[model samples]
Target: MIAAEQVRAFRGMTRAGTRSVLIYRGDLFTGAVTLVIQVVLAIAVWRIVYSGRPPVNGVDGTTAVAYAAIAVCLQSALLPWQFSSLPMRIRTGQIATDLTRPLGLMWQALGQNLGVLLARLPLGAIGLAAAGLLGALLLPPGLSALLLAVIATVAGAMIAMLCNLIVSMVAFWTLEISGPLIVYRFGSSFLSGSLIPLWFMPDWLRASIEWLPFQAQVYTPVSIYLGQTRGAEAVALVGVQLLWLVVLTLLLQAVWARARHKVVVQGG
Candidate 1:
């Protein structure tokens, strides 16, 4: 339902975000190397944990390793180190100009994050390729699952971006969010099932994580890819993601309203 002009403006913003990442191709290379190393280590850890043992709670070593690799790659692309640039803009007062733009500030930021995701995908693919080369990666069981995983992955990326925006908007109040940001980064890495697949966790832990939006970010997509969650279950998981998308979108809007108000009050 977006207008043509709005779509065009969004495309330009997305390209600007893409260009920002590509401008430092060297960083992408370095990031790829780092991603590869991290994925390799993750693969090793999972393999070692399941070494010569039976599948833990219906999760085989291959599935675990594949999940780790895919999760790491998703973490890299979907969850950037600096998830949002809003905090910096807040410090520089550029957020004021951003608010006055034709496009919504949140929409504009989402476009930029999407652009970064596009640019970083190559790095993720490299890490995936390395994992495959090392014989630790596995593709989805079928095209249907693969398609659903793609859908789930897109939803997950949006959820993560919204969460990042929520964090970034904290700067509007405190003007310093490093501590919270670091906590959120690690917390998300663990809770999103990127550090380890949800299957590897205890039943109680898995149940608890299912209630959180983080699992929809990495766990759901990778689990779908591994065919761990199939058919109706897979669809339901995507449904859960859509649910979080709605919840988080509303939350972000509420936060953005307050942030905008704070900016206006202080500027006056």
Candidate 2:
């Protein structure tokens, strides 16, 4: 277990990062507006698609809209833009300073990314509220579901961070990470049900992606939020998320060790 002091220090870093985002909130205004527009457009299309149908793949129009709204709001948190520059930092040798910090490098990175999410929460909540007011989204089913969704969403975010960390660490070996980054971003966004519900996908494809961590990142949390997952199934989903967390954490540690050794040997 991490000692109290270590946890406190990590929290301090998180708060500092959060403050940085707040200070420069204007820089993200355009992106936030774009997200809102996308949410509106997605709801509009789904509305037309489900107009006459009672349900498409077990999701009715109302549930579909709610899912889309929540997914968009959480998208920034799940796949933060801040982390996209990690590979660039690696290439520019800024990672050397990061390594020299007293905190564990992985913790610092995760804390900072999470801070970005925290900073975005207020605006995200407003966007969701606006969508709800405009009849494009549904309120969460119940308090219990909302609480459970919060937990699930946090787990999802952690999974996303770990995956991104692993991807960014590749920069230690190769300067060109664009190709891999593109593949990862698209694959995760599509397969994770951030753009569309996994239930709407073909059976074969859905079944295949279900085993991957990408689905656990968005679909599971959204489903829980919508009350589509509960009881034992909800427990199982959280268990699967925990399992992946352990696996990814171990993989990251091993990779970071190799990366640090490479950096040191190269006179970084």
Which of the numbered candidates is closest to the native, going by highest lDDT? 1
TM-score for all models, in order of appearance: 0.96, 0.91
The 0-to-1 C-alpha lDDT of every candidate, in the order given, reads 0.88, 0.81
Q: Stretches of candidate 2 above 4 Å error?
A: 1-5
lDDT of 1 by residue, 23-120 (tens): 98788788988998998898888889889999878888888888888889889988888766778888888887888888998889888878888988
Off by over 4 Å in 1: none
Clashing pairs in 2: none
Q: Return the number of clashes found in candidate 1.
A: 0
Candidate 1: lDDT over CA atoms?
0.88
Tell me, by TM-score, which candidate is best.
1
Mark the 10 consecutive residues where model 1 has the least summed lDDT: 78-87
Cα TM-score of candidate 1: 0.96
